[model samples]
Target: MATTTGEARAGTAQPASLQLPGIVLGVGLGGFVDGILLHQLLQWHHMLTSTNQDHIGVKYYNPKTVSGLEMNTVWDGIFHTVCWIAVLLGLAILYSRVTHSRRRVWTSRVLWGWVLVGWGLFNLVEGVLDHHILGIHHVYAGEGQVWWDIGFLVLGALLVAGGYLLQRSGRPFDPSAPTRREARRA
Candidate 1:
């Protein structure tokens, strides 16, 4: 296909490496917001906690079985550390692949989709396992918490769908574009 001047300039001027790093950075920042602001800094809830129950009858269960399950700051810190690790990993992947001397290595659709899917998966899994099953935390214990969690999941699905559309829109990486050495070689 013949390249227009504008297209040529855009292709040549902007490097994929530069664009991808920001997206990865965004993922890290978002993770921080969730782990720090929502989970730890606010102390709104913990990853695991016994559900509140009201009972007038005498306790049937042994005290030892239930005593060890209380919320602790140490566990919260560990969860936050894991979140930071995930963000760093995402950043590393984006930096290595997108910033390499390759043309169109980072597609907008794919990158956005990745972020959405990843974020969504994190929420869905965490919600199901921690909030619903283990009773470690409720999906939204605080005001507007449920809405935020739902929004995160929905946004993730949308991103994945948007990425699929972008991929199908006949916008494959042009491996023969001479301006980029990697593209020219392919």
Candidate 2:
């Protein structure tokens, strides 16, 4: 008679761990889009500069130094580089999984879903803090900016929720349960 231990054998495959790099990448991508398009490309406003200005007796002078422009660009570039690194790391994890021929697991999906959830949460929190609490910027800088920002939050939430649902559905991809086909042949 053959005996088997309760625990899985050493050669047994394990599910992949949650991918942190991917999560970071997703968050970084969102931040990059916001900073690049909103702050830099479109020139809506400078992120690091203060809107408030003080006036001197002889001449109206802003607190910001002339070097603020260069500083802003450098800051933006650094932010972009960090984001890109996150993206690349995420891609590396995903690609390694693909190359290894491992079965897809619910945990992997859940991990990715959480990343989206985290990103959405970050956006909502930062939006409220910066626009409402700190008054650094108006919620709606232009005619429709508020709507757009709200939409972005909503979309982020949906991505998270949808990914969770996909992982939980548990439908069989192969359409063959381990025993069903054998029973049919017998």
TM, every model: 0.52, 0.50
Model 1: per-residue lDDT, tens digit, 63-137?
124443233454666887777876787667665554342435444443554455455455556655555455455
Total colliding residue pairs, candidate 1: 3
Q: Which pairs of residues have clashing backbones in candidate 2?
A: none
Give the C-alpha miss distance for residue 177 in model 1, angstroms. 8.9
Q: What is the C-alpha lDDT of each candidate?
A: 0.50, 0.50
Q: What are the per-residue Cα lDDT tens digits for candidate 2 across 86-156?
A: 66776666555443223443345545564565465546655665554553443335577667557656766
For candidate 1, list the clashing residue pairs, or say none: 17-99, 48-136, 49-136
